[model samples]
Target: MKSLCRIGHSLHSRGLTFGSSGNISVRLPEGGWIVTPTNVAMGDLDPSQLSLLDDDGKWIDGPKPTKETFLHAAMYGARRDAGAVVHLHSTHSVAVSVLEDIDPADVLPAITAYYVMKVGALRLIPYFPPGDPALGEAVAGFADKHHALLLANHGPVVAGADLRSAQYAAEELEETAKLFLLLQGHKIRPLTASQAAALKQ
Candidate 1:
């Protein structure tokens, strides 16, 4: 709980997320999970107020889970190795999402080695109204193959082996998105598929 609060606050304070526009969750070893409460600003999350849910997704304690609980569950269900999930309505990432002509298969180009190594290929998920159950279904379908997804006209959702890893990857995604937007209309050099694959090794 302390770790969750600390990371959430850090992300919020750093402007990676704002207001009550994002949600985060960490899977528990004993089969349930802990998530930020609905409509609570990440910067203001009270450890004691974090919501708890059983493996089946039923609320077990604390406040109500974020309305996007199903989305978190879907990621967890799809990726056995996913230990944490971070979803944020970050400015640059959201801006990239709404832009037309970006390849949906790889929304952000591999502009930096860290971006390639940490974030990999970012799949773009078509927009769905926030908290819609269908969003969960869509994410689940690709969660196993991709660690990160950009929701069209929405934002980014990233899953990692743990919370800090997830947080770092999310930050990398945001930075890369910013770079992508800034380089628009300029001849930019992005890592090629072969170069990115070599970095993955």
Candidate 2:
């Protein structure tokens, strides 16, 4: 448990994550989930501070879970293939959220082969107040078509088959967001639809 907790925070100190702004959860092999507690910095997670919730989203045991628990619950419900969910407020991604007058539907592109293959597709969900149920709707809107999502004014969230994969995807998002920022002044060529499809194959 401590090990998992550290992975959450390490991303913060390393500058890939920050601001008590992210949450991580794993579906225990037996059942239920182990989630980071609310308002606690990911870097500061303690085993005792972790919350356990039943599959129904009820507190089976442990401290109070995050108010955003519903968002996590929505992911679990929408994605049977997901074993872990990680949410992050990485700086560059949040920064990109407000820049580049790109269309909402096409915010994510196959600009990089790695992003195309690793993330498949990225969706942008409209902003909702933190801890609001509306966030679940924004997230759910993209769940059927995307594994990664950028919250309008918030951050990014991803569901992976496992924790490592989830973390990796989160890292990839930050990298791409950084690229999106750095390339702001340049002419960029997005991957053609056929090229994007080839990578999917």
Candidate 3:
């Protein structure tokens, strides 16, 4: 709980999350999960009030989970190794999501080795209204192959083997997005496909 709170505060303080624009979840080893409640600022998550769910993803205790809870649930369902998930309406990532020319299959270029290593190939999930089941389904379809996804016109969602891993990957994604935006309209040299594949390997 403390770790989750710390991440929430870090994200908010660093401007990755503004207002209540993000949701986070961590899978419990025994079963089920804990997720941040809806409409609460990530900077102010209260550990005692975190929502708890059963293996089925039903809210069993504490406040109601994020309306976007399905996103987290979909990720967990698709990736057994994903111990935590972080979804954020971060600035640069959202900016990149709305770009007309980005490839939906892999939204970000392999601009840096750390970005390639931490986020791998970032996919795009088509736009859907918040809480829409279709969004969850879209995420589920891609979650199996990619741990990081950019929600069309929304933001990014990332999953990792643990909370810290997820958090770091999410941060790395936002930084990469910022870098991508800065380099637009300029001659650029992204790592070759071979280079990116090597990092993944």
Model 3, 60-107: lDDT tens per residue? 999989999889989999999999999999999999999999999989
Model 3 stretches astray by more than 4 angstroms: none
For TM-score, candidate 1 versus 3, the one ahead is 3
Candidate 2, superposed: residue stretches over 4 Å from native: none
Please list all clashing residue pairs in model 1, or write none if there are none.
none
TM-score of 2: 0.92
lDDT of each: 0.92, 0.81, 0.94
Cα error, residue 11 of model 1, in Å, equals 1.1
Q: Between which residue pairs do clashes occur in model 2?
A: none
Number of clashing pairs per prediction, in order: 0, 0, 0
Please estimate how well model 2 matches the true structure, expressed as its whole-model Cα lDDT: 0.81
lDDT comparing candidate 1 with the true structure:
0.92
Clashing residue pairs found in predicted model 3: none
Q: What is the TM-score of each candidate against the true structure?
A: 0.98, 0.92, 0.98
Error of 1 at 15 (Å): 1.2
Candidate 1 lDDT, 119-197, residue by residue in tens? 9999999999977999999999999999899999889999999999999999999999999989999998888889999
**Top-down TM-score ranking:** 3, 1, 2
Cα lDDT tens digits for candidate 2, 1-201: 876687887887898766677889888888899888888888788978899999867777887787788777878878888888888888887887765586677565567888877786677788788888889977877786777888887888888899888888888888887888788778999888899899889
Cα lDDT, model 1, residue 145: 94
